[model samples]
Target: MRLKVLTCLVAVAALYAPQASAGSKIRVETRTYDVTGASGIELIQNINRKGPKRGFMAHAIALTAYSASWDLVMLRRNGSCRVRQANGTMDLVFTFPRVVSPMSPALKRRWSRFMAGTHAHEATHGRLARDMMRAAERSAVGLETTDDPSCSKARREAGRRIEAVSAQYEAKQKAFDVTEHRGGGHVEHLVLALIKP
Candidate 1:
C-alpha cells in the first residue's frame, strides 16, 4: 500500500517556462527489513511483527510512500497572468520484508513468490501516485487569471486545483485498496498463501 502523502503539499509554489520533466516517473527506493524465521509459520510471525507500521493501526505487509514537488512557471502580459508550465515530480519509497533466516529450499521458493506478488502490489500504488502528480501538473498548467497582474489570483486558483487533484487521486487509491483487500480477493489470497501451514 502507498502512503496518503499530502498531494497539495503547499497549495502552490511560484515559478515560469514550459513544463519540465523532473518527477514524471518514479525512481522507486526499495528498503527491506529483515524478518527471521525458518518455516512459513515462523516467517509469517516475524513479518507480522516486524513489517512497517505505516497503516491505520496494524502493520502493513509492505508500504509505499509518495510525495510530489512541482516546478511552476507563469507568463504575464497585458495585465494577464497564466501558468506557462507545470512540471510535477513524484518520489516513491517502498518498505518490504526480507527473510533472513535459513529455510528449506521449498520454503524459500514460496517466500520468493510471495514477495514478488507483494512487490507488484506496492508498485501499483507507486504508479497511481505518479498518475496523480501528472494530473496535478495538468491542473496547475490550466490555471490562469485574465486580470490578476500580480498573479495572486492565478496562484490561488492553482492551489485550489492542486487540492482537488490530490483529493481525487486519494479516492482512487482507496478504491484500489478496497478491491484488493476484499474477501478472497488478490491481497487476501496472497496473504493466505504466505501464511498457509
Candidate 2:
C-alpha cells in the first residue's frame, strides 16, 4: 500500500501556547468481502481463492490496509504570534471474507478463535499509526517563529519534522510486518490454528 500525503494550510486570528497538544484523533474503517465454505480448509481456500500470485499484495485471507495523513492548520494575524494546530488522521482498513453464519458448534468455535487472532494482528497496525500521528502532532504544536512577517521558514521546518517522524514510523511498521509474516510467526500460527481440525 502507498501512503497519501495531504497538507492543508490555514491562517486564523488566534494564539496557541508553544506546547504539545494533549489529544489527537484517530479513525478506523473496515471493509469485507464474501467467501463461501463449509469446513476450515475450505474456508481458507475460499479466502485465498482470488489472491494475487505476486509480491506484497494484501488478500482477503486476513489483511490490514492502513494509511496515515495530517492536516496542518497555521494561525497568523496582524501583530500576533503565529500558532499551528496539527490534526493527524490514521485510517486503518481491515479486509476479510464473510463466512457462513450457521455452522457446527466445533467449527464455529475454531472460526471465532481465528477471527480473534486476525483482529488482534490488524489492531497493531492501527495502534502504530495512531502513535505516529500523535508524535507528529506533538512536534508540530511546539513550533514557533520569531519573525512575525516571515513565518515561512518556521512552517517549512515544521513540515520537515513531521515528515521525518512519519518516515521513521513507516520503517518501524515494515519491520513489524516482516517479523509477523516470517516462518512460524503470528500470521502463520493463526493459519495453522484455523485448519487444525
Candidate 3:
C-alpha cells in the first residue's frame, strides 16, 4: 500500500492556498501542561521546565504539530492508470502552557496578556496546517499519468506534489516566525513584557 505521509516539526507551523475537497477531513486537538509560577519570571522559568520540547535543548512556549495521511485508489484504463480518488485525513495537535499557581492581580494581568498573545501566535499555525491539508488533497485527487501502467509513477507524483505543498508551507511558516521573533518583533515584545519584573 502506498501511503502518502506529510509530517511537520515546528514551533507551531505552515500554510497553503487551495480549496478543500470533499474527501478530506482534519481533526484538531488541544492539550496543556500545567506549570507552577506566581510571578512573570517564575512563569518563564516554569515554562522552560514544563513547556513542549522543540529540539534537544530548547522548549517552546507553545507548539503545534500536524500530520497528513491518505489512501489513494488508482484505476487502470486503456493504456494508462489514473488516480480515482484520494480520501485523506489531517491530524493536528497544539500544546501550550497552563499556570496552576495563584496569581496576584498584577501577575494575572500580565499572564492574561501573555496567554492571549501566545494563543494568537499559535492560531496562525493552526490555520496554516489546515490549509496545507486541503492543498495536498487538491494535488492528489484525479491525478493521472500515461508513463506507468502500474500506477506507481502517478502515485509518486502525487506524493511529490503533496511534499511540495508541505515544503512551501514550511517556508511560509519560517518566514512568519522570522517576522514574529525578530529583535523588537511582536514575540520579543510579548516575551519581554511578560518577563518584566
Which candidate achieves the best TM-score against the true structure?
1
lDDT of 1 by residue, 1-197 (tens): 76866453333334444445443555568899999887777887887788888655578789988777665567777778887666666668899998777878788888888888898999888878878877887888767789877877887788778778888988988898889888988877887786676
Per-model CA lDDT versus the true structure? 0.76, 0.66, 0.74
Question: For residues 1-197, what per-residue lDDT tens digits would candidate 3 score against the true structure?
Answer: 01113553111001222333447678888989998877798989988887887778878888887777776666666557666666677887888888888988988898899989998988888788777777877887778789566677777887788778888887777777788878999888888888787
Supply the TM-score for candidate 2. 0.77
The CA root-mean-square deviation of candidate 1, after full C-alpha superposition on the true structure, stands at 2.6
Tell me how far candidate 2 lies from the true structure as C-alpha RMSD in angstroms.
Answer: 4.1
Per-candidate total of colliding backbone pairs: 3, 0, 0
lDDT for position 28 in model 3: 81
lDDT of 2 by residue, 1-197 (tens): 22333433333334443545534566667777766667888878877775322245545465555565555555555533343677666666666656854667887788889888877876776677777788878887747766565556556767787888877887877788788888999878988887877
Whose lDDT is higher: candidate 2's or candidate 3's? 3
| TM-scores for the candidates | 0.88, 0.77, 0.85
Better of 1 and 3 by TM-score: 1
Pairs that collide, model 1 = 15-73, 16-73, 23-89
